[model samples]
Target chain A: MNHLTLALDTMGGDHGPHVTVPAALQALSVYANLHLILVGDRPTILTIMRQHRASESERLRILHAEQVVQMGDKPLHALRRLKHSSMRLALDLVANGQAHACVSAGNTGALMTMAKVVLKTLPGVDRPALVTALPTMTGDPVYLMDLGANASCDSQALFQFAVMGSVLAEQVAGKSNPRVALLNIGTEEIKGNDQVQQAARLLQSTPHINYTGYVEGDRIFSGEADVIVCDGFVGNVTLKTTEGIARLLMHQIAQSVKRNPLARCLSWLLKGRLKKLFLQMNPDHYNGASLLGLRHIVVKSHGNADELAFLRAVEEAMTEVQRQVPGKIEARLQSVLLEKSC
Target chain B: MNHLTLALDTMGGDHGPHVTVPAALQALSVYANLHLILVGDRPTILTIMRQHRASESERLRILHAEQVVQMGDKPLHALRRLKHSSMRLALDLVANGQAHACVSAGNTGALMTMAKVVLKTLPGVDRPALVTALPTMTGDPVYLMDLGANASCDSQALFQFAVMGSVLAEQVAGKSNPRVALLNIGTEEIKGNDQVQQAARLLQSTPHINYTGYVEGDRIFSGEADVIVCDGFVGNVTLKTTEGIARLLMHQIAQSVKRNPLARCLSWLLKGRLKKLFLQMNPDHYNGASLLGLRHIVVKSHGNADELAFLRAVEEAMTEVQRQVPGKIEARLQSVLLEKSC
Candidate 1:
């Protein structure tokens, strides 16, 4: 049937099997030929599988992974000690080519560490970055890279992230030479810290890139640029703050609407629209952040991600596989690495 | 009536006299003894003032200045050359005690430099920091420091920012022993870069402040902490990103509501509450980020701020005057500085 199978860490995430199981079933239903290596506490997956009457259990193979990484545990500690952990086992499946990719809604750091140790960096990648797509005001997605992958980075790393982010956007989003920007305080050439300024210089002179110069934080969601690049430290903070602020705003709107009966009636009328908006802002919709430059695909879903988010993450991996994005990124990055050596 | 006059820079912001003049008049309406020194192009301010039929023209002293600081000009270059600029003149009034504080929706960097050079830093204060209050999910505002004042900072600088942020929160928000937190990638003490880790060590052991330990960016708007401290670089990015994401989400909500007649009707009903929520997200409501550590009070309004924002900034200055927050912050910081030198 020319379909692909993915290994999912169903025991991961806050909702665990409740959400993961349903999402797995949903994904399987969408692609009749899709098989899932359900890695988790086997009993839990079977119990969840039974609820869905997933006759496709024949396609869904359950692997007994006795442990799941807690969100708070150190990544190194979790990976080094928990060899049979669900996330680790999932990565092994992908590494050994038992599955095309590994997806987890667990500890992000632990996922990165396991993937790195198991699969290793693609030929010439020095560091792998986590890249996620954010919806812009123009209704198009903007890919932001190094979103908490490496908290401290130099100019060369940022430039590489831009290259990787751009390649992914082109391959996955199907954009041709997406307009790229380095996130900064001001749009001026002279604005931002040393790393951002240095990256800007490289991007400006780089021949193959569609460099758009510096973009202020305010313009990030405006669709002013297609690819936003920054050090993992800033990108991580920016992404988290954006989510927090959205949640805070949504909560505030709910409280204000409930304060009066007239407003309450209006909220009911607008409930569907508001839900859609919330869904659009949902961390799940953009849940899967890919670890770019890895030899094999590894997508880290949010720890508290729901079924919908996990489903999207699995879909993201499938898309990556279909487009051969990882291979293309590796080739482009390898050339840069070669040039640097010369 | 211990209230004092404030010098308002009218020829500032993307939408200048149109918004600034009305906002100044609005501020004067709230405070009975309020006097405004409208520093800008005389003809423009007069025309707007006349249109508003502002009865307090006598109280509204227009100090005509011929020069203006364009947003693109370098901060140091503008501050040095544009000596008679409206923004510079406004700060001069405050520095000379002709006004208790200066307010400007002008070139932020220029205002900061001019204020620092003119007002000088409080003894034992290394640099002045810009502080703003962000609305949190708990319905109370969390005070965040160094919202783009100093780009690069040391451990001591961050520690001092925490102390200053704590004092301002307590004095202004009536928060007793405000919980202070350093923004980091992770909650662990050893998780962040060297500066963040070192800052954590000192903040955790500080006696004058109620240190709550490190908080991730997601918790900033959750109201889990009272005072959030970070370097100017991180703070600026966080603040702007919050605004950008909120705008994106709200716009998405509006678009979704218009997709169908039923949803559109409901949107209209809940429009007031939604608008109120949006207003709370307004950057201007949180305008007048104070330059703490300055010997004299210095408040910076957003360069693209409107009249409503300028009025809110005046209110912020008034709050500082009543709380005498700077004095308290200096006293605590001096003791810490003394200990360090010893």
Candidate 2:
């Protein structure tokens, strides 16, 4: 906890170094114990820092990355051809013990692939799951995974996701004995598919998990469970769908107010309150999603994250490093898997 | 087109006759040529009608049902024991020639099971998909399915959904050459699973469908594609997640406003506008989801729908009845299947 180092994929995402450079400086200023290694085109990073009237100190360093990963780069293509890309170098820094964590707002597919290839999966983890905290109505945010990290997960993989998700909820979110639930369909009707049903069976027989029975999707935001588990495909769709609906309703509210003069005048008076509420629901506010089950920490920010949102990603990485998330997850998973065998 | 008759499961939903009876009368008042047969405990329906100083007239009639399907009833159990239930009786009316369609705000599992058994699937259709209209940002609502009708779907079944969804959009929504898209995960990165890829191939090859490749969950409300197809599990989770997120933000907004006195007072001034916006986003506004691919028309309303929401179900049933959606779907599916065979 005395010293923490994080590698920033400065050439990742839509804005690349322009956003990541300022965010890295902001994070360092806030966390005096933090050290940041900017991994991108060195010239671009230096120019951005200069524009902000900033220079490198003992807490900061620049590592040049020859290439940048585009937003649309395929994972395998980036792995094979763009090995020196900023996203890849950031993970490599963590892989080689040069940094405790890596944060990127870059191409998700490329980052997931390069992180897995470079850092490798934690022992006993088949594939890493993309995990993030979802805001609830009244209680603390619930952790959800595997947000498109693995498209096709079998029952065992799903069970592993439940384990990793629970660990993150406990260690990162500080929820004790966090109740975990499998995201399944059907309210009072037919249940989920074989993969989910099998996962439920595995979780039910395990003492390592505080497994509540299956939960419907409507219960996701109700805060009835601490960690919600699903395969990458379902989780990804659900997360994106939530984003889409939030934006839709917000747009509808704004457009409706624009049509009426009296309502518009009254709304302008309450604009400050409304703006605060909108920010709370905005997807950008919750930017960092950790790629769990990896050997080391790697936090993925949104592709279009702004300076503050990118800084949120850096802070998320800091928490994971401080909590030693990977080490705790590896220990917990090994015990759970061992107990399951018995 | 001149006369449309819809059977109502008056003993369905949480409020039973209290909600359905009033909604039936309202539907009758709206459409002069519409007739409704209320299936429930005859005395309860009569008492509610008497409370309104009304009697059964030529356009409205009451039929006795021995039982009512509870919200938690399992599909197979309800199918076997609840033969004379109000939900079943309503479908029976549509199955025979007593009514053109059936509207039920009852147990979804029971309604789907009984409707499928009594009405059977259309020719060339494997199973009926639960279809609903989703609100879009700048265009007419998009048709999404299957919203939990089938737990799993193969490539062929997904192809069938695309074909059927197109018909609903074209005939009921009055959209010509409606663009069809398969719901997939991974945005600018990895693609979907084998079934989805195979379905994409089928859609691309078929001239009958205006295939628009794969669309992610975030694009559901973007108004880009008119029809989005996915398996029941995925579609169900997406729909419910949308509902959950919408409610979460609404709750957050209401709670935030309550904490500020100035905001609350001014909000009360703009109450009419805010209330209108809330009403637009409320899940109850979209009550009915049609059981597509059935031989007879069936509109399944939410189990907790109030009087007005239940009336929306009746109106949806009327639209499907007027459009003769089942026949259009059947004819279109038959041709699509034949072409596939050739």
Candidate 3:
């Protein structure tokens, strides 16, 4: 790849072009061989570029997107009506091969829907699952899929998710045949609802994948598994709960340290370690949500993403393009789904 | 409350009486109107009791329970076969009214099973739900009901759970007209599965609860509502996810902060706040899982609980007893169920 170009949705996220533009510039500086196709309001993009003292504004081309997708708008309505929305135009770039990959921090539903409609799922790919990487206790990040894409699921979809998630883990984490576990109420085969039970049966019999049986929500943090798979509903709930609890703890710690003189002394003792830990667990550190199993690479940034977070999403896109993740997923999924039909 | 005699299932947790004994003695000093009925292997309890020079030991009585419930043993098997288990005998005390409530950090299923068979559900209460209090962002604890008692729930059971949970919130959190929300995939009335949608419709039209419509799992910590009602399966998954995420973040924080000197310095500055936050978030501080809709109070302590956690369970029991929580729940439920019939 001489100079791979990624279409960055600059008008996306809570901070829009102000954050996305700077993050894109940072990525461009870090990777000299990378190019960016910035999609947003022309004036805002130019203003942000000027503020960054970016001379290579020519290298980062701005594509005017007259409309923007608001986070609160109905996903289907926004996708259907706002054809010129920054997120839609960015995704269209990938669909039409104008860019190597697409990254967006806009309305998640709209982005996913547009990507699915424009880029379409790989043949035999049942659902384009959203995968979020979370930092584990062992300092390695684990790939957790179906964070909020599909609320309801079937056995086949979950099995496919396992395959896609496993491939991503292997490529991203460099763990060959990473231990993949089906998130369930218990580790027993008999545990969980019909969807999980069916998925377990399919996963156990499926070859070419290392199935680690069921893993409870508690074990997700223990760094025991590399790839955790569950229905979208459970995955979404788990991810959000994790975020909420982290915030709650962080806030409480701040309150406690500021409360008393003795605590102040203790805080002084542990200051360096705590901030490092807090930063490590920061959501921005693992900001990208990969739209796995699609024909093209599409990473969803958090809706409220800042500059650093959007940059992380760009890095994710770069990594995916370098790894040819979509092609790998296509090959693995084809074999699995083809074998099932045979 | 004249010298309330309580049975501590000393051999119940992973660390057992080592933690439970010290915690109980500490609690004895704190709660002057408390007595002990230490139930476990006589020699072990005696050894631990001898270490603590607490004068309350004179009032301490040991009941030999040779068989203990293994954490991994099946719920019903432990309940039926382990007739001589300390956990069982502890429940026996409650069944016979010798003790007001029983606290154990043993197999949760066995505790629930034993409680149901022993104490029975309150009148008009079809099922006994498990309720756990999670720290909310609003600086108040939110009561999430049916955390895992029943895996599957119908519309009626969920509604009843809302009633029971709301009453507990009002009685416990002191929130009058405690806002009740049905946990769903989305906040919209039309956003969830058939079960959740039906529950939302019932909650919306129903007059008893201060229903706030549907709430996604993310909103649980947002503190937008006081009581969140969901089927046992969803609630259990959400609760475990919250726990798993908290543990994940804490482990990450500890590992990162301890790695370097500057990070350690930052950790020192944040240690007081961190400890306070972590301790507050510790399941131990809010260790009790109340058996709701039951005629009597039954709190499920963490199976791996230490002494401080068990002592907190005792305090929780005292709070319930002093507040007459069961009676209030019973009265509220009776009135609501009666209204439903009409």
Candidate 4:
């Protein structure tokens, strides 16, 4: 396997370097051909690295960033003021070809805005979509797109999202001729608003794309479709709702087990199997969300992700790097656009 | 409490008289003051009633309706051709003041259309919103609205939904001042589309409705807000996604328990508690979805709901009828509209 280099935004996310440095070291241990450039405050990064005995590793390096982008900072404000922040510097490494990809557990808006400005979008792509894999009953993950990147999208933008999402699933997930479906309230043709309806019409006409008409939210986990496309508003709400429900159910189960004596004993006996099952469905297991349609790869980890979760994001970025996802998307999109113009 | 008579469409839902008849009979047994008018084919209803030993009950009565509305029938078609259908007859009982409310597990579109045409909207309501209670961490259910009655809505329609939902929560759920929040992609003021943003502004200034800003989809289960309002498309997708996640998690847990010997043994020991927890989170436990803003109450059960689920719908309708929900909403909406006009 070829070497994959990732730029780590150490000063990002809730715990910053406390989580990122350990995650970076763990990723290095997992993949022998991996290298990481840690971007953050010099003293903080060095201290954490020394504590972890990580300085002796040849694959690890550090780049000091002058400023940090606070989680509460707006995208535009971060873009204008925090030019040398860790998040911006990490993406700069990807744009400047110093790394194969950039991974950040930072403010989603700031990371997206900075990556767009630094890496630019692929040709024939108007906007980048935040794409993430969600676990399905079939055991194969479904790639869901526009997970809060654009609050509102037009028909044309939704069309682009479908294109970008399909390409990502096909190229990265290695699903040939992936089935793509537009997310709607109902499966009927007359169900959604004009934007989704129009996008469906466009997808149906587009050649070389397996555009399944529409899939309702209830069918998302059924694994009937490989890629589910929607505007960011609907997509974000759907993803968050799924996460919230999972947490609520687990909490309820815990409470039930505690209240019953037999349940408590049974819980202890079934702890291993139950823990494995919980981990399989845990959101942290699928923490990385790729910023698709950018000229280079940039993966966004959850803001509150711990070391293990952040490492999963790094692995996600490495997979996209190996697959050459950005180039594949550009080629596919260009061909589709050419077909349309003709 | 005064006697509350409910008109149930015995021919509606997947199992028709099989489920609805049993459900109605079960409800009568639970509530002594409750009375039911079962409308469907007379012979089918009579057979089921006799089989259940329900014919001896004085509270149960049969209303003959020669025609039946198929689940696939469109609302307009059902209105035009199936005037005397069981579903239509049930709503008619409510419209003619013979019953306090109507309950059906029929086609949602047809039910909404027929009810709107027969009962009409309240003085100020422009459209009827679909409202249903969702289980929350606090054990108090949150009333979520516009589950799929209207595909699209303007700012004013959303405002009306908020007003209607707030009143329902206050009157039926007995919350003095329900904290109402607009469902959005983000909690920030500038997060959603123009319609939602506009609705938020309107709700913030509206008097008497405890307008807590925006709540994200993930926070809906957190039980922070009593009423969460959104357009039909978003609401429908959110509700379905939640149900899908719940089913997926439960399935996975069952699989995990089955796969391991110790886990299987433990599952049996904990079966009682686990069963109770699952039952609490089960969608069927909260089956009824009330069609608010109509002059009279109409509760829509899930089309595939079983006997127990259908009985829950009847219980939901009774709660609203006892609370005089429609009358309370009309009074509240009239006052809110009056305040707006002044």
Query: Which candidate leads in DockQ?
Result: 2
Write out fnat for all predictions, comma-separated: 0.76, 0.83, 0.54, 0.81
Off by over 4 Å in 2: A187-190, A282-287, B187-190, B282-287
**TM-score: the better of candidates 2 and 4:** 2
Scoring only chain A, what TM-score does candidate 3 earn?
0.95
Ranking 1 against 3 by DockQ, winner = 1
Name the better of 3 and 4 by TM-score: 4
**Estimated TM-score per prediction?**
0.94, 0.97, 0.89, 0.96
* iRMS (Å) per candidate: 1.4, 1.8, 3.0, 1.9
- The best candidate in terms of lDDT: 4
Query: For each candidate, how many residue pairs have backbone atoms clashing (under 3 Å)?
Result: 1, 1, 25, 0
Better of 2 and 3 by lDDT: 2
Any runs in candidate 3 off by more than 4 Å, and if so which? A50-59, A261-276, A282-286, A338-342, B1-7, B21-37, B42-62, B152-155, B183-192, B213-219, B231-273
Give the runs in model 4 whose Cα sits over 4 Å from its true position. Answer: A56-58, A271-276, A279-285, B56-59, B282-287
Cα lDDT, model 3, residue B112: 83
lDDT string for model 1 (B1-342, tens) is 365778888888788888888998888887887888989999888888889886446567989999998777788898789999998898888888888777787778888888889888877678888888888888788988888888778888898888888888888888988999988888875577788889988876677789988888878988888899888888888888877776787688778766788777777767666666766664544566888987666677776666667777888888787677668888888887777667
Please name the candidate that would achieve the greatest TM-score relative to the true structure. Answer: 2
What is every candidate's C-alpha DockQ against the true complex, given to 2 decimals?
A: 0.70, 0.72, 0.45, 0.69
lDDT of 3 by residue, A144-232 (tens): 87887887788889999999999999997798888999887767555677888889888888787899998887788788889999888
